[model samples]
Target: MNTFLFSLKVMGIGLIGIFSVTVVLIIAMVILTRLFPVSAEKQDEESK
Candidate 1:
């Protein structure tokens, strides 16, 4: 039982770390995109 509980704690910590890193990366990407957004004209030219 003790070992199981410890394993659960470790798993939970890993999950939290993964979730936090993912959230941070998503936020960073959003900020970066906002700071340097693509123009509609550029997209239209690329589509041609």
Candidate 2:
């Protein structure tokens, strides 16, 4: 029972770390996209 509880605690901590990193990455992506807006003309040219 003690080992099981320890494993659960580790898993919970790992999940929280992963979630925090994911949130940071999403925010960074949003900021970057706003700084460098994409042009429709560029997209059309690339689709050729």
Candidate 3:
């Protein structure tokens, strides 16, 4: 029983760590998107 409980605890901690990393990546993507805005006119000009 004790070993089962320990395994459960380890799994919970691993889930938390994965969740934290996902959140960080999402936040980073949002910040980068805001910093790099795309414009249609800019693309047309660059193509010429």
Candidate 4:
């Protein structure tokens, strides 16, 4: 029972760490996209 509880604790910590990192990365991407938006010309060319 002790070992099971320890394993669960470790897994929970690991999951939380992964979720935090993913959220940070997503936020960074959103900021970067806003700071460097695509040009109208580029959009037009891609549409063709």
Candidate 5:
């Protein structure tokens, strides 16, 4: 019983760690995409 409880605790911690990493990566990707947006073809043609 004790071993089962320990395994459960470990699994819970592992899940939380994974969730935090995923959230951080998603936030970073969003910030980067906003900072470097793609130009439209019309703008490119006008600039040339």
Candidate 6:
């Protein structure tokens, strides 16, 4: 029972770490995209 609880705690910590990193990465991607946005005209020109 003690080991089971310990494992659960570790798993919870790992989950939290993964969630935090994912959120950070998503925010970074959003900021980068906003800072250097791709225009529709550029895409249309490239499609030729």
Model 5, runs deviating above 4 Å: 40-48
List the candidates' TM-scores in order.
Answer: 0.67, 0.70, 0.67, 0.69, 0.70, 0.69
Instruction: Put down candidate 5 lDDT per residue, 1-48, tens digits, no spaces.
Output: 999999999999999999999999999999988776676555777899
Candidate 3 regions exceeding 4 Å error are 40-48
Instruction: Report, for every candidate in turn, its global Cα lDDT versus the true structure.
Output: 0.92, 0.92, 0.90, 0.92, 0.90, 0.91
lDDT of 6: 0.91
lDDT assessment of candidate 3: 0.90
- Backbone clashes, candidate 3: 0
> Candidate 4's error at 27, in angstroms?
0.4
lDDT of 3 by residue, 1-48 (tens): 999999999999999999999999999999987776677557877999
lDDT of 6 at 46: 93
Model 6 steric clash pairs? none
Could you give the C-alpha RMSD of every candidate to the true structure, in order shown? 3.8, 4.1, 2.9, 4.0, 3.0, 3.6
* lDDT winner between candidates 3 and 4: 4
Comparing 1 and 6 on lDDT, the stronger one: 1
For model 1, the stretches where C-alpha displacement exceeds 4 angstroms are 40-48
Across 1-48, the per-residue lDDT of candidate 6 in tens digits comes to 999999999999999999999999999999988876778557777997
lDDT of 1 at 11: 100
Kindly list the per-residue Cα lDDT of model 4 for residues 1-48, writing each as its tens digit: 999999999999999999999999999999988876788558878999
